[model samples]
Target: MLFSLFSEFNRVDAEDILGINADAAILVDAETGRVLYEKNSDQVLGIASMTKMMTEYLLLEAIKEGSVTWDQEYSMSSYVYNVSQDYDLSNVPLKRNGTYTIQELYEAMTIYSANGATIAIAETIAGSELNFVKMMTEKANELGLKDFKFVNSTGLNNSDLINHIDDGQQLVGEDQEENVMSARTTANLAYHLLKDFPEVLETTSIPVKIFREGTDDEIEMENWNWMFPELAMKHGTPAYKGVDGLKTGTTPFAGACFTSTASRDGNRYITVVMNAKGGDPRAARFDETKKMLDYAFNNFSKEEIFPEHYQVKSNKTLSINKGKEDQVKVYTKEAVELVSKKNEKENYQPVLVLDKKLLNDEGELTAPVKKGDKVGYMTLESKDGESIEFLDGSSLKVDVIAAENVEKANWFVLSMRAIGGFFSDVWGSIASTVKGWF
Candidate 1:
């Protein structure tokens, strides 16, 4: 559901993606879903707390639909309370039968990756976590997420947790149910969530926020997304500074998974690192992300594929038809840009294949053309390069439209053009005959 107005993918060489620390990983241009890099990206595995993203998304959807409000309060269920006590699962303790607003619990769930808070909110919206997880799977399918499945609102794999999925959900080949997703699926979901509800970042970016503040039960929570400025600073790497919002998940089954987004100099990137290797696997994910982002920010850039505003700057042009003023100027209807490694724009080329009937014997258009009328389209293609992988297909295509309206010429004018064209052809033929005689 990462809505891209333009379908462009910035693919990279396999060698360029070499040595990434994670078992599965991907780097994508967030806005365009242009996948810049990936390895085992489609392999599904336990996604751990990243499942809360679905829970977060459903909660936000409910809020938007007016089914729930941030101001609305719900009492802590005994099930949620019991799960909160499990230190094994990341949780903010929920007071049994105690009340908290949707806002407070949302902050707890998102900022702390709190298991209890997620399930409590899921139950509030879907009537039960089991049903909520079903909604999650449906949403995933709707988003074209192949092989991604959810069994609980929280990402915990322990069937014993029993707090989220009361229906005893289980996958066919797995012992117990655990929400599973490919890195590609997770990255796509993250892209859409960020696009639709950017406000989630306001909470996700908060390094430390107190839930139930001023109450005796107040608990201080910190974000696990090491990409965030506060946590990134702890890594002592200045390059990790721009990463503002994302979720991180770790479990025995999932290893370490981080779906991260970072923006710098107006260019933003999203990366998913899964099942990273290292003693400190969390750091491993961050390290791998740093590599991709570094390559992207340093090597690749966006370029406007141009010759616009009705002016044919390149060899491509619009043919004018039967009008007083012959053919009017034509150019790309929309502004578009190509992203690739620096200077690859040399191979980045455009092809102008216009509808021929629109053209005359001289390859000129029959005018009486209306402004903005699409006479044809120019498909831009970039030849395969040594390094950067430009988007496949017509990554950049624009409707070639008439720049100006051309009124029909009078009969006299039309006759004059015909006679002139005729004489011009005749003279060329005569000149050729004269040369042969010589």
Candidate 2:
């Protein structure tokens, strides 16, 4: 249920803006994995509570894998209750020994940015906060988040007890470093999760919503992200359209950070800002995101690199050596779309390469083939290394058949047959002449 806008407009320079000194930032195409714009993208820095994004990813992954379900119930422990009591950032008012459904906890965590709810969910998912942190680290590595690490579920500064002790000596102050992530890796993780589990957005995109149990008090949770309604109106720019559902963070050390996703005409993009300095981090995020969105929409477009039903030339038909079909026709699965600059159409070209072993030596089709068989693949590479799959629109199945039988004859047999045919032809010609005279 994600979308993007496909059009051309003048590009805007985002780096020239004021009050936008984030340590890292990145704008990437969600569908194509193309980096549209970036600044200090790989620099590791404190991302504050944007760590909740990974917490959300792990929760959704657990749900998808059947490890947990929405209606499943969990009880908060004293440890969670204590954190809730002390944290002023966000909370679901969870009391020790009180039961809440997994769905309720997720709503609270994502929509309300409830720190207490996040801890409860992490504990529920991994049986302990420490285990959940390990899971988060593992998942980050699994997703190729090279520049990120997780020591806590909420991304708050961990208590001194959580720090490693060296030779019975506790490291303190400047010697202690906290977990961090680069803007690019954070955006990459967000992009991968959102691209895969879009249902998470259904909860994240809600600015104001209510969750309750029958006869229980309705919990009113408001989205912390001001960009949804506040910035859209403030900017008065249509480029803000299709922007929705993400997290925002700010702290004295982490500064201000945001990971935002937007879609238009089927192209989705993710933008991340980290360690920004401003009185109001939300406003800064909104302004910076608007500029990025505007630049992306105005300068880039998604074009079909490979046309639908495109025929791959010089495609050697696959032959079945011993199957009923002797040959099979193979083609690409679908047409590919490329995100390219508006006026750079001349740079696009399609390249086809086939696996040498997949074809016969004579360049004829190979048999033992079936429909939907992948005999080969083509890469649609631009002048640069930017590439996409060629001819992958609708599934194109192999449509050719093999020879019914093999014509076999020895040299002697062929020569005898030829001689007999020649004698028969001469006899038939004489008889025809005799009949004409008569």
Candidate 3:
């Protein structure tokens, strides 16, 4: 799909000429959901252990739902143990009877890219790896992950393992299950997850570290992502500025793949490349990611599409229930940003649309409201009614609260109000009477 959502830029054909044999690629503005660059991004392709993005996402979701805790210890299962038995495997060496905290397992899975650690984590979080795979597929559908499947937590040789199933069902393990994902979709998933759960970056971005238990052997883990060092040298120390985490993946069938994300001065970007060909997939991904990042950071600047506290037209006050104050205040959560042409203010205009149903028919608000409550929404559209491209055409949410409360009116208060009204009326009458006599 052509992403006309953002203004297009001069195309770069270096990947083609340089023989960067990637089957699919995409670059996007993280905060605005703008597609900044793409090359065959929609073609479905095998993505290898970049599949772990889904695994990591599901694990975080499990934690959010209270199904798992970072400190909780879990036992290693037979399936995980068998997977670890491959001597050539880059295993985490988890013992069948030994236990590790969720945090330790997560580090192993993400940083060390330990297959056994991932399978154990899945089994621990969801009772079984099979059940966790089911959850992964279900959540994939929920998140609009159109071209993907999960038959195993470890992204192992499912193609060979499932060929024996006689049900004729397209078992995820058979050659029929080439766990596919498009560059755009993969980047979108990573971007959304990282944007929502930034803690993942905290683990993935570490350039190098040692994981150890006191008195136990230490395991050295290095960030497989190479863009950090490349950018550092190219830009001279802390290069690629805000560039940070993500993951790198490869397998013979999937070729090489990566999803890299970086943020600078509040602007974030995500780039994905799948099926690149080279000696080292991780290094290839790093080379491609650095090019994409340079293109973006050099060409674009984040422009605020809406100003903070910039009163949105049609915003209505909301009432409070049992609040210490009778009413509360609300506004947009954050100003939206758009990557526009160097100077395109004339092309920018944001419009507001409130969901009238959220307000009472009498035009009065009802509330037990908070500052960020979804009181209404506004859509920023182009003057021609075509939706704005950079804003992703998503409606911005507004809060519901009374800007301020009207002081209470009571019976005694009414009596005093009446007395004041009578005296004002008498004074006006005497003044007019005196003026007429004069």
Q: How do the residues 1-438 of candidate 1 rate in per-residue lDDT, one tens digit apiece? A: 111322222323356345787778888877667777787766676688888888888899899999999999998766777888788778888777688899988998988999888888988998777678778888877766665766677888756475443344332223465677777778888987887888887888788888788997788898887766666678643337678768888888888888888888888888888888875887777788788888778877777756455344563455455678754777778865656667766675667667776677887877577888887777666566433321121244578787778888889988999999999999999999999998
TM-score of every model?
Answer: 0.80, 0.71, 0.68
Give the total clashing residue pairs for model 2: 26
| Alpha-carbon lDDT, every model | 0.75, 0.67, 0.66
Best by lDDT: 1
Q: Which stretches of candidate 1 lie above 4 Å from their native place?
A: 1-13, 16-18, 158-160, 163-175, 232-239, 310-315, 319-328, 353-368, 386-394, 407-438
Give one digit per residue, the lDDT tens place, for model 3 in 1-438: 122322233333344422335777877887767776777766666777787888899888889889889999987666666665555555666665777888888888888777778877887877776678888888877776655556777655565334323322233444544466667678878876886688898888877667655525367766666556643464333345676778777767777788888887666888888876565554566677777777777777767767655455444344543334444554555565567544554465655555567556654445444445555544455554433432133443433223344444455756776798899999999999999998
lDDT measured at residue 193 in model 2 versus the true structure, 0 to 100: 79
lDDT score of model 1? 0.75
| Candidate 1 clashes between residue pairs 3 or more apart in a chain or in different chains | 320-327, 320-365, 321-365, 321-366, 321-367, 322-366, 322-367
Stretches of candidate 2 above 4 Å error? 1-20, 160-177, 210-220, 230-239, 309-331, 356-375, 384-438
TM-score of decoy 1: 0.80
Ranking by lDDT: 1, 2, 3
